[model samples]
Target: MEPLALLWDGILAATDPAIFACTILGAVIGLLIGALPGLGPTAGVAIMLPVAAGFGGVAAIACLGGVYYGSMFGGAITSILLGIPGDAPSVMTVIDGYPMAQKGEAGRALGTSVFASFVGGFLGIAGLVALSVPVSRYALAFGPTEMTAMMCFALSLLSVLGGRNAFKGFTALALGLWLGMVGLDPISGLPRYTGGSMNLFDGLDFSIIAVGLFGLTAIFTSLEVNVDKPVAKYTFASLLPRVSDAVQTRWQLLQGSVVGFFVGVLPGVGASAATMISYALAKRLSPTPEKYGTGIVEGVAAPEAANNSASYGSMIPLFTLGIPGSATTAVMMGGLIMVGLQPGPLLFTENPEFVWSVFGSFAIGNLALVFLTLLLTPLLAAALFVPTAYLYPIVIAVIVYGVFAIDASTFNVTLTILAGGAGIILARLDYPAVPLILGLVLGPLLERNIRRTLIQSQGDLLVFVERPIALGLFIATVFVLLIPLFLKLTGRKKIAADEAEV
Candidate 1:
């Protein structure tokens, strides 16, 4: 069937009143979950999986889709307003977003985020609708060798380029990798570093680490640092991005959307990797790269677009090939199964209406999410007005609640607290935490794939070079790692030559 005709069918199917209600309610819940710490889009969707199941397949999918994209917008709330990320995807948003907030442009940051996210979301859905089959088939070409190299390339993009201190960034990445390895070995089924505790059999929950690293760390920092800048009232003009702002960020939005959607199509990568990679890509492409962290609208636009696009891109594989591109989509796959809607090529042939309804829902969900985010901007911005002395306790409480909600485990909460202290120390030392987050997020994929590749090749290093795609990805990873160093060295030499001439 033609893509547009299929999409139109979906639009017709989604006009049912129940689906609309599900989308709206799910968006509301998703926004709330996303604006809170610890419970990211994945956890939010996971927690609501059973409840959404009761709504039936179409309604459940619409609801889950709403939440997925809604949380993408909501993540920017705390990231921009509070210097804390609501979820992992929004971590990049905090780099420039909170600074914009501090500069009394919280509204603009929020607006830019929503707008960019909408653009990304729309593009992602469009791609999914048009190219789902081709993309899924193309992805099938990636074997274990290709996956390992691709994962390495993805991890290298951020860990090498995003931080000022390469050594520190690597250290943080190492720490995250260690954290990812602390539980039982996935292949061996033996405890690696559980320390005789049953709580760690399932590994450290990423949500706990996420909440502790950003939410609790922010609270701890606020408690210790006494900055005297009084909160300023922001007018509507200062809150919204100007037309010029959009014009400036248009390229960034496009770049981020493309990068994110493509990367998100790969299984297990998620929005975290998409956002980090897009941010680095944006910086590399930017004329004013140094201004990224200090606050720039482009910086805010890029990752927001990337992560949203990635979310939509993730659904493509889930629908077409019964593969999940991320943890969030993995949960969504379960929902599909619960509703008796098995994913695969047969789904399009057997349940065309269901397929189209999902695509249509993504379109509607993105539009609705934009409005919800804009409407809630004022209220989210109001959070910035509260004094940190009074506000941080609430944040801490929320962090604890959010962490505890995952698995209902105390060990996870304890890990959160410990991670907070470690985050504070890392921040004080200027070691980047974002790279660590990426490492943790990508670790399983990296490890599992490499192990699988090794097993397939019987420990032959030549396997990496034998395949064309794997070799390309390996070369790309090396290039990504070396380019930054090359640039730094050449830059230093240029400066030295100029000084000597003077």
Candidate 2:
């Protein structure tokens, strides 16, 4: 009853004219951004952070949240029409979607994609609402020791599972940790690695780093790559899917939502992975597996559903544990802090209205996207034909203006440029940047708690091992770290067995 009452309050709050307008506006902007190739939700959220943070309320959060999920819906547009994936998760969509477009079934393919996305988003948000409150309530009992262990577990999981190469992931994390340590010591008033610069006194803002690494780096990289624009081919008659198709694919959509949401709740296992897993599962279960990737509606529906659900699934850890489950959430977490709100268990207790309102706004945004995507699909598709050259200047100007507006500091602008350069270099080297962002975001929190615990225990290290919750968490961290090793050994044994059989 209490949860229901709180949820109703949230629904009411989101319906406010101002908040509703922002939510719809954000959904529209996010769709356009997502439809553009090479700029997924991660960059989209980071690029919008500075502007949204300034609004600083449920409206800001609503807008950013809209962008986060709205992009998931938008990615399907390019995949179905152009044979080019607008984002990573949408890559799977291109396999069947492009084929369908060639068959003159583009409208059906797109309608199926949008429907799947709406259903997936609905299920994911429902899961979030159901899980977040109880999980946060449970987290409230954590002490400094337990909190420290939890952070360690989250970081380890991200470093180990977040990329193709664990070593490269850890290297990125090290860079982030170094950056995290640059500010004044959390305990001591004296600066540690500020290099005697007054600008470094406040530490590097995650929002600034996010804008440079995600937003600016994307711009610089896009300018070097050339993309061919394909005209959209579809008729108004088939724009909306047949009811029979929806009925037939209903079970697969449900399967995708379930798989995506659960996978997304785990730290570092992102939506791209969820789509792959869901698509594979669908193929395995299908009687006509051979039909996959041959312009089938089920092929397009499964991955589309999974990616959208996974987006919501990733938010659980971000909201309840103050840990981001994916890169986009990490940027959103930074934006939350910039607006004077801290995400964690305490946030629920401290500001129930704000938390619920944000959740409510997600529901509203998800619904709004359905109409927006349907009505504007033709127009947005045409906009995609515009040359990339014309867009680069506008993106650059937005990035520059957003960063400079943060604190009006020329020094921060310099830092942003440096980070963008480093980001480009890192991208070329195949180094994963998500862990770096996670490390930077989680480092200070880990440090603060560890210091507080040490001070409380008079520098006794056993306090970490003595606490049962902390001990359990550390053990989980070790298990997580050994997963890659286990997989490597398993692969070697399988190869040897195959040779013996031959």
Candidate 3:
């Protein structure tokens, strides 16, 4: 069957009333979950996986896919209104978005976010449609060596390119790698760090750890900060962007979408990375780079668009290669597996309906997100008025409930709390949590693939360097490690020259 024909059939299946309804419902749930401080698309999808499992395959995929995009749209609400980023990706939005809000343009900022999100998400889905089949075929050639190399490249980019401090990011990566090794070794079947506890045998639950780090820690931090600061009231009159503003951001939107799509296609480089990268790129290319942090519409549009596009771009690897490109996509991949639908090349041939439904649902979900945001923004903003004292307990309960619901294990809940506490400490010390999460998520794959490659080559370590793809990744990793040093040396020289001038 031709790819176009398959896609057309998938579209028809996705538009079926049952699937459409489920998609709408999923979008609503995802938006609400994403608007909350600790819950992102990953936790939202993970919490809903069992429910999706009870449904059939098509409905399940549609629902989970909706949640993915819905969360992207909803994340901006908190960033704009409360100056609290609901997810890391939305942190970029806070740069211009909060300023717009402070200037009594909260509704306008939100409107721009919704529209840019729709455009970026739609374009990203289009890229997925055009690329998934070819990408799947390309991914079919990836062996253990290639997989390990790809994982290395992803970890390198995530750790080095993430935040201001490279050492802190590496520390987070090491901690995550250590945590990832706690379970039984996949190749040797020997326990490494179980510490004589049967509960540790399965290792830490990713969902529990994510919730603790993102959700619970966020709540705890919120308690430390005052939440009573006044925000500009938003009215319907403030809900639309100026035509001139839209025209001005046309270039930013285009550039941001492209940057976002490419970055998001890489495993573990999700919307957050894409947003930051896009923001940097936009500023570099802009004539008004200095105006970026001052609440310019272009700044808001660039990051918001990039993050949303990246959210869609994340689906590429998840659908085509069975590799999750981001944490949110990882959760969606779990949903697919739960429904007896494995992601990879065979998914296109055997489960065309599911594949198409998911892609098509993205198109629909993007539109639904716009409407849902318009309807829910006021209500969500009003939520800020509720006292922190009352809100923190509820947030804690929800995180605990959501974590336990994943595996129905109390130990998982304990892990969740501990991870949250650790995450809070890491956040305070200026450590990057994304790399830690990425390391934890990718550790099993990295370990398994390295061992498999070594075994395949009869314990030959040189095989990785001999392979072109692996060699390229190794070089890229080295480059990533060295770039910061080069930049620091150059920066120091410039500083010394300025001091000499003084």
Stretches of candidate 1 off by over 4 Å are: 1-120, 128-132, 218-361, 386-399
Question: Order the candidates by lDDT, highest first — what do you get?
Answer: 2, 3, 1
TM-score of 2: 0.97
Worst 10 residues of 1 by lDDT: 224-233
- Tens digits of per-residue lDDT for model 1 on 378-484? 66546445576686565466556655654577887798789888988998999977667657756776788789989988999899899998899899888877877
Error of 3 at 432 (Å): 1.9
Pairs in clash, predicted candidate 1: 10-356, 107-239, 108-239
lDDT of each: 0.77, 0.89, 0.78
Q: What is the lDDT of candidate 3?
A: 0.78
Candidate 2 Cα outliers beyond 4 Å, as residue runs: 494-502
Candidate 2 vs 3: which has more TM-score: 2
| Residue pairs that clash (backbone atoms under 3 angstroms), model 3 | 38-215, 212-420
Provide the lDDT at 391 for model 1.
Answer: 63
List pairs with backbone clashes in candidate 2. none
Which digits, one per residue and each the tens of the lDDT, describe model 2 over residues 1-502? 6766776788889999988988988898889878888888988888888888877889898989988898999999999999888888999999899899999899999999999999999999888888999999999999889999999998888899889998898899888878888778877788978889888888988988998898888777766544565655888768786798799899789999999999999898899999999999999999999999999999998999999999999988998889898899999999789878899999999988999998889998998898899998998888787777787788778877888898798877888888889899999999999999998999899889999999999999999999999999999999998988899999999999999999
TM-score of each: 0.65, 0.97, 0.85
| Reference-based lDDT, residue 16, model 2 | 96
Tell me the tens digit of each residue's lDDT in model 3 across 52-126.
655668888788788777888888888888888766789999999899888888888888888788778877877
